[model samples]
Target: MTSIDRKAAADVIDFLHRHFPRGWKDWGRDRSVSCTMARKLLIALGHATRAERGAEPLDPPSSPGSLPRMDDTLLALLLVAERDYGFGQGAHRWIRRMKIRNDPLHRDLAASPDVFAFFMELGAVEDGAWTEPAIPALLRYHAALDPLPDFDAVPGLHAFRTNAINEIPEDVAAEMSDILEEERPSLWQLGMMDLLARRWRYPEGWLAASATGPHLLRIPQDALASWMAVELIRTSRAA
Candidate 1:
């Protein structure tokens, strides 16, 4: 391995330390863990040092090699994140319907937004199309984190209103297909809706005023919406 490979390997070791602060053995590494990891890393990168192929321990001097050329950094990052998410259809892989982390991988992608786009595109790699699964909401989230590359070019961005609670939008077979379940930022429980409904003492005689006057209050359906919700008093004024 070259100096670059050594440096990258050292970085991966640092990542392993971060991942296994209590030590790999504590994390339930089998006796054969070293060989398994080293061999897998080599296979994943399509290159290996003689030492990696053998049983000698992996230290700072060894690396899988040429991560950028192989786009193997994703695999490196996934080593940390694979606990929860990843690509491919294997039951072990599920990153597509999940969120990315706020860790090193996230930081790396934040540094190079184009790289982030490329990684996200891999979620739909089987299609072999240039289209990415990214939607306006996800892109906007990236924007807030200072990673959206073509900021001005990505227009028609709607502000995410957390206070505006809504349901999961189960119409998967409709115009809303582009929206992802998690990226539906319009949905969040303020936790006040039900509380206010149950406990807020309405001002004295407000109900009477509401009864006499033409009052209209429109509430959007939220995750808690069974349509069995108790309606609060509605009021209106003549235009």
Candidate 2:
């Protein structure tokens, strides 16, 4: 059996310690939690790959010519640094998603304004064709952080909203309008508008306003009717 590389393991632990100064408190005591964090970190660092069918035992380094391998015990210790620093699942996911290919270096994965902006643009798309599950997850992650990204600045958001309005039926559009008029718009409302706008194809000015404006309820009834007509014609064509 190949032995674990103690120096490589120590380096990983040291990296975590430097990144997170605090020692793992609540998260360190549980063996299971530590193991989970370690596995995720390994995946992010390209040291491990998740099995599609079921959990597989960590494989030893292929050969001396390949990268050094750490044992499960040392891997678990790496999580102590992660937990001590308050890095959560969200942070782990971010690192995994954004880690660059061809770059073996893995220590620097801090969130930034640019990363947040990219996530906002990702969430702006509502089309089933282009939608991503990660966008919603990232949005939820950012919701807990201060100084949220500006939705208006998200590229292609206007085009996404325009497309949604052009596809939905008139009745559905009316229902959406009613929902908006009756209550304050939340993320759901924003998403609905994005869909309705795909079919409605409202003017660029109006589309932009509706997206960033204070209230969807403030849109004039006549404008809403005009937008609704587009869906009606579309529905009739299919009939």
Candidate 3:
């Protein structure tokens, strides 16, 4: 990946800070306007190539009802990050952390009915899709909502699930393994296993959880490690 020119990026960000001191609200209701503004800024900063700058407008006035294109949305977000938090590795880190935590921007987007609907449609296509790259971020956003959307219906759901499962830190995985191996795993442990099995389509016989009490369940321990390893390997390959 090409490293961003921090100084140059900061200069552009500084310009935006001066113009929009109050954040996104300054841009008004139409996000396309924001995208256009960002595109102009990029061109002025020489950050955008002639080809990019010449690309067709993602939201032409005639298509006012259409959701903003993925490229346009990303450009807008990149500019928004710069406007609110400046530009650098720290800004990038903040964006990634916000995606994971499903806080601030992600939360705000999910809460907006129109924007949420736009994402839902964007996430429905299986191939030749624009939203695949943004699936992980969208999933994280959905996860933060009070009534979580149906993840099974989300486009690229498996990809995000695999990515998330594989990205689990070693220490966390080990702790999970320990908990799953207990004679009577806690309800939380069983619930976690159930979620993994159902969402990732782990073999039913390999690791099954049965509700045996009000808040307790029967969990298999003998094949726990093998089952988890197989599932992880399978998902890693699929992703």
The TM-scores of all predictions, comma-separated, are: 0.24, 0.25, 0.25
What digit string (tens of lDDT, one per residue) describes model 3 on residues 1-239?
01124453444445454455543345323244343455444433333322423423222113121233232233343334333333212224333321122222233331122222333343422232325445322332221114544445545544645566756655445555564555663444454555443322221112223311111111122122223444554544355
Following a full C-alpha superposition, what root-mean-square deviation does model 2 have from the true structure? 18.0
Q: lDDT by residue for model 2 over 69-149, one digit each (tens)? A: 222222233233234333322345334322211111112323233332332343312321213333321221221123433
Compare candidates 1 and 2 on TM-score and give the better one. Answer: 2
Q: Candidate 2: deviation at residue 197, Å?
A: 16
Q: Clash number for model 1? A: 4
Mark the 10 consecutive residues where model 1 has the least summed lDDT: 230-239
Which portions of model 1 show Cα errors greater than 4 Å? Answer: 1-8, 22-39, 42-56, 59-70, 84-239
Model 3, clash count?
0
Task: Report clash pairs, candidate 1.
Answer: 215-234, 215-235, 215-236, 216-235
Q: Which stretches of candidate 2 lie over 4 Å from their true place?
A: 1-141, 181-239
Compared with the true structure, the alpha-carbon lDDT of candidate 1 equals 0.28
lDDT of 1 by residue, 1-239 (tens): 01124455445445444544554332333334332443334433333333423433333443332343112232333333333222211232223332234321123222123223434444412232212222211221221123324332323211112111122123311212232222533321222233322222111101222232111111121212211121211100111
Ranking by TM-score: 2, 3, 1
The models' CA-based lDDT, in order, is 0.28, 0.34, 0.36
User: Quick one: ranking by lDDT, best first?
Assistant: 3, 2, 1
What's the TM for model 1? Answer: 0.24
